[model samples]
Every structure is written in C-alpha cells, then in structure tokens.
Target: MHDPATLELLRAGKLEILGRIVEASNATLLCSVELDGVTGHCVYKPVQGERPLWDFPDGTLAGREVASYLVSAASGWGVVPPTVLRDGPFGSGMVQLWIDTPAASISDDEDSGAGSGSAAGSGSAAHREHVEQVSDLVELCPPGAVPQGWMPILRAQDYSGEMVVLAHADHPGLRRMAVLDVVLNNADRKGGHVLAGLDGGVYGVDHGICLHSEPKLRTVLWGWAGEPIGDEAVEMLSKLASLLEGELADQLDEHLTIAEVQALRTRVRRLLATRVMPEPSGMRPAIPWPAF
Candidate 1:
C-alpha cells in the first residue's frame, strides 16, 4: 500500500510535464510531481486530450481510472497504483504513481553485480531471474508446448504461418487480478497492463475503459475459467458487496452513473452466488486485440 503522504501529494501537488508517452492512444504525459520537498514521477492523462469513443462518453475516462483505483484499494489487493483525478498542466486529468519494475531498475543500475560470491550478488541474481520469468506473462509458444504450470488461452498461426499457443502463467497475483477485472468490468485488460512491480507485487494499469454498466469484459486472463473461486476471493467479494451498500457506493457515484454503480453491486452479488470463475460469454470477443 502507498503511504498516505504520497497519495496526498498526488492529489495536491505541482506537476511538471517531462514528456509524452508516444505509444499511448490518448495524450498520456510523463510528469514529475513535487510538494513540500517530496517528489515522484507519474503519468498524467488530461481529459481534454481523450479521443472520443462510440461506446464510452467523452471526458469520463479519467473518472473511471480513479474509480478503478478505489475498487482495487477496497479489495485490499493493491493491484492498481495510487491514482488521483486532479488538474494538471494540460487540465483536469488522472494522475497515477509510476511503478518501477525490476527490468527498469536493473537497466538503470548497470554496475549491479549478479555473479559475485556475496549476499548482494545472490539477491541480484534472484531479481534477474524474477525479471526473466515475468517478462513473458502472456506469450506465444510452439503448439502444445505450454510451460509446466501455464494455461493456454488460444492456438493460432503466427506471422510466418507457424502454429503457436497463447498462454499465461498460473500465478496467484494474476488470479487475484482476474477476479478484480471481473469486478471492474474491465473492457481492456491487455497483457501489457500487468506489471511485475520491483517491490514483489503485481500491478495493473490503464483502466480508462472500465466500470461500464454493460457486460463488456475483455481480457487475457481466462486461465481459471470454471474453476471454483478461492476462499480469500470469496471473502473479499462479500466485503465488497457490503461496502457497495454503504460508503463505497457513494464514493463511486462521484465517477460513475447510478445505474453503473448498481450494476457493479449486482455483478459482485452474482459472483458471490456463482462461486466459480467466469468463462467467455461468447456474445463478444473474449480477449482484447493485440493481446499485449
């Protein structure tokens, strides 16, 4: 969990635009936020820069991003980073703490030893191994050659017409994220959104297209479909159901419509009743395009 002070800074701080994330569909800016001698990097997505979508209402993506963060925090999963909707240099937008992954850390410190016969060397080696293992949470492998514990989602021909299978690791953090995605009604849970945090936690990002009233779930996490929901997830969902009846509903209302909030409640109740992981609905595409 992020410290209260850090969240407060994100909510109320001076932002300086460092650069733009060129690959993003929206005007996502890399920024440096500072207040009272505290400083950190963040991503700022101004509302005015959002591209209009046929499905989602214009200028509401920032609110949905904040709402997703709230739900993640309430679930005690800490999957989403600390995010806030506040005015930036461009305009009012969503500002989120930048998560530094193991790969980024390793690249930033070139002198970090990985082969020495010391405690630090052993730790470095472990960190490198973690980075290597998590670098491909979702990937294509030779047909029927899925990793030991990984789950295959689809099999199709690659660019060169070679047969390959798309799969993801059977990881606990990813399982929790899949459940969270169900709750968020996330329409775009691409593999790239899943981050292996340097602090040994999994984080999800880019939640601008979530919390819709309709059933628009699209993700690469169908590995646990039809399996019984875990005990911890059941308890979390029950607590979330109660929270929706009380304070959480009001909080979500600031960002989502009344119908949308109610839909969220109904989804939680339905999950509690079903007690099993959901499968693809077949009404729509189960996974987002460009899966990564």
Candidate 2:
C-alpha cells in the first residue's frame, strides 16, 4: 500500500513545510505532502540545504538518498523506506515517506522492553535468568560466556554499580539490512537511523553518504561480522548482482559516477563470491560516531 502512494507523492506532491528536524546535522525538514487530494507526512532534504563534505561533492546527498533506495529495492530486502528525488519549495531534494514509530511490547516484562535498540550502547543482560527465557532472541556477547547470536553494543554501570551490556537482536531482517549496507557501501549507519514502524517493520534511513567509490562502510549492524551469510541473504545478493547490470545500473548512473556504479556492482559480486559477512577492514572505525 505504501509503495505506490510513496512514489506518487514524492514525484508530484504539493509540499508544505511543517517544521525543521533540529536534531539533524544536515538541513532536514518535516512536511505535509499532498498529491491528487491525498495527504501524507514526509522528510525533505533539499540539495541547497546540504552541508559540505570533504570527501563527497557538495549538493549530492539528496541523489545519494534516492540511489540508496534503488539499491535497497534491488536487494529485495526493503530495508530502506520509500524515497524519491524531486523538486520541492526549497529546490531539488529527496522526499521520503515518514514512518511512525509507535512502541510495541517485545516481552511481557516491562523492564525488558527497549526503544529502537538505540537507547543503550551495549545489549546488557538484566539477569542471567532472563537470558534463558528469551534465549531464542539472544545469544552470548562473548564466546563461551552468553551464546552465539549476542553481540554487545554498549556497556554501562547499573544502579548497583554492576556493569551491564546492551545488545541488539541478531534477527533475520536486521541481518538482511546489514548485508544491504555492505552492498551499498553505506558510510553512516548509526543506531538512531534504524527506525521501527508501527506495523512491525524495520527501516534504515539517512543514506546520503552511501555508494562512494571508496570502501567507507560504517555501521552498528556488525553483530554478524565474520559469520557465514545465510542462504536467503545470499540468494538476495545474487538477485541484486544480476539486476545491477540492467535497469539498476542505468538508474544509478543518473546519481553516481560511472566508477561508483561499477564499484557497486563489484561489491555485490564480491560478497556473493565470498559467501560470508565481512569483517571491518580496519581502514576506518567499524562503528559510526554518536553510535545512536
């Protein structure tokens, strides 16, 4: 239902500014967009609103956002929300449908509930007994300590002065998103950028710094690093690699250089060949700044 409306509104919506996203480092605005008498909320990031980046050329973030969406769709994981590049009141920009993030109960215990998996840096265990109850959802952070699926993201002191770890669920959808990031060469995938929709959908946004020719993948979804890529994800990667040679490649050319487009194809093929999740190259920090 969201796919068609998202495309329609983004391409022809009459945009009306609702407010600015003050927390965003770039020029991000919230607006009400109307198209063919239908109204919806969306995020607008204008080209003129972009800040200069030493590596990325100026005023190209909006296009990058659209490119990211294309890659996401090609992967067939739908990790990214619907995004399109169009002209707005502020000028040319990327307009994306807004995802409402209402809270949901992950567990019966209120204390075990988390918010978008960004509040704490680490996935700390409140009690060892709790791990046994939700063992299906989590694994040990340290080998031989907790289990296999657990990857610690943050560590903090509890009120009793005991250190606790905060970790994210290493679920299938998230693992797919991680693979999606690798193929796109996403440079900035902070925790907060991962949104939870009211309908139990997970989305990754703020993809303006993706698809660089250089290997600049920085993300918080490194929990599965070095793990063998699952059969389903491997199949998806294979599908995207084939699609890139055709329509996807042509579409990307409008937003990226020939070299960058080729690089994207190369990355996908390499992942398919390797058949494993990649470890940090150590060229840069594996995690993005401000982690959340």
Candidate 3:
C-alpha cells in the first residue's frame, strides 16, 4: 500500500541496490530504499538502462514514468503506484514501490499468438490451468460478439489450435484506467501491466512510454470503445482538467516539454467535452506487441 508518507520517502530515499532484474530488457534493479526510518522495496530503472527509442528523447523514460503517476493521481484513481525520480546507484532513475501479488490470477500465455506448441511444451502449464479454472466465469464468445458485460481485447489460439477471444470483465477501476491512459497517451499498456493488487485493487505499471506529445495511445483496453464515459469518470476528468492548469502542470513541466503538457491538457478537455470513452484512432496499431 502506498500512503503519502511512504511516497514522500520514495521521493527522497537512500537507495541500496539489492539485485538486478536480469530478465528485464533494460537496466532494471530491485532495491531497498530507506528514508526517515522508513524502508521499502522498489523497482529502479536508471536512465542509462533505457533502450533508445527513435521517437523518444534519450534518458527521458524515467521522467515519463513519474508523469504517469501524476496523471493517475490527478484522475483521483490510484491506478498507477507511487513512483518518484531520484538518483540511485546506477544513476538518476525512476523508483516505484513494489506491489506484491499472489501468483497472477490472470492468464499470461506468451506464445506470440499461437502456432507454437502444446501447453506442456509451451512451458506454462500453471497458466493453462488457471485459464481453465476461469473458463466457466468467462464466456468465450465468437469474433464480433460484444456481450453486455464483456469486451473483446484480442484473439489467440488455444492448445488445440482453436480460436480463443480474450476479453476483460467490465469493471469500474478498469474504466478509470482507460480514461487515464487516454489522457497520458500511453504507448504501451500491455495485459501483463495490469496487476491484481494485494489490496484487492487493480493497478497498472510500466508507464515509461507514456505522455508523449505525439498520439501513441496504444493499449489492450479498447473493449469500451465508443462506450459512454461514466459520470464518475467524467467528474474526475473535470477535476483533472483544472489541476492540469496548476499543480499537475507544474509537476509535469519538470519532465515533459511545454508542448507535451499542453497536449495533455488538450486531451483532458476533449475527453470531458465528449463524455465518452475513446475509440481506436486508427493512426497506428491499436494493440501493443506482446499484449499480455
């Protein structure tokens, strides 16, 4: 759980490198950070660890990560965890308080869209079993099916080479996250990024590619496309709109360009005026690669 005092500690903590996340593509590390007698575990990603992207400025991913946290706070929904920018052992980086979760209750079959192998050969028997456990809870509708409670996210092949459509249950927090994503223009919202928190809440992470001035809002949460924005979310967006002119804008100015911040405010206004969930803009791929 991320309380205000804990967040302040994370912002101004002394970090000790515990270990490196070898599996991560970039320079990601696990650290024990302490401040004012408060100690916590955090994931640290240094600026030097970032893989260079053609579209984004070098060493700016850490800033974008902090920006995402600000947007999550502005939305009045604690979707993104508490993140802060600080100098670490590696260098200046982004530090996020780690969230512990039970073995993920959701399926994360990383077969690259099927045509791969059997579940046993796929090396994810546990995940396969979990998918089966939820078979009754989730109705696998056919393509083009838009049930009242389900929204299609992607299509994948099952073990038997059968087509299986993956959809998410319509939830309130998820809807708010979708609105937050639109405002941040998040370029990467993978299924694996959504974690079932130990606090019994859903949270999103790995927002290093968000808040660019460009329209890079690719995600897997398009099930609510064209749906009307709920009143609660609209009110939150209105409040966020006002904050963007003052506190939010000031914090973002430290990380993003003036144009990018302006673009973010523009998105807030547009979402509030429309009062509807956004549809795929068709400007780019709607789903991020390795969606889950």
Whole-model Cα lDDT of every candidate shown, in order: 0.84, 0.75, 0.76
lDDT score for candidate 1 against the true structure: 0.84
Ranking by lDDT: 1, 3, 2
Give the winner by TM-score: 1 or 2. 1
Q: Write the per-residue lDDT of candidate 3 for residues 1-292, one digit (tens) a residue.
A: 4467868768787877867878666788877667766566678999999999999899899999999998897777989988999888878999997654454221223221111122122336665554343332223456667466777777877668888786766766677778889989999887777765534456888899998888999888887889888888888888998998898899999999999999999998998899888888777899887666
Q: What are the runs in model 2 whose C-alpha is more than 4 Å off?
A: 103-150, 154-166
Expressed as tens digits, the lDDT of each residue in 26-90 for candidate 1 is: 99997777778666667899999999999999999999999999999889888899999998888
Worst 10 residues of 1 by lDDT: 112-121
State the RMSD for candidate 3: 8.8
Candidate 3 minimal-lDDT segment of 10 residues: 111-120
TM-score for predicted model 3 compared with the true structure: 0.82
At residue 83, give the lDDT of candidate 2.
Answer: 90
C-alpha positional error of residue 190 in candidate 2 after TM-score superposition, expressed in Å: 0.3
Badly placed stretches (over 4 Å) of model 1 are: 103-132
Consecutive 10-residue window with the lowest summed lDDT within model 2: 112-121
Best by lDDT: 1
State which candidate, 1 or 2, has the greater lDDT. 1
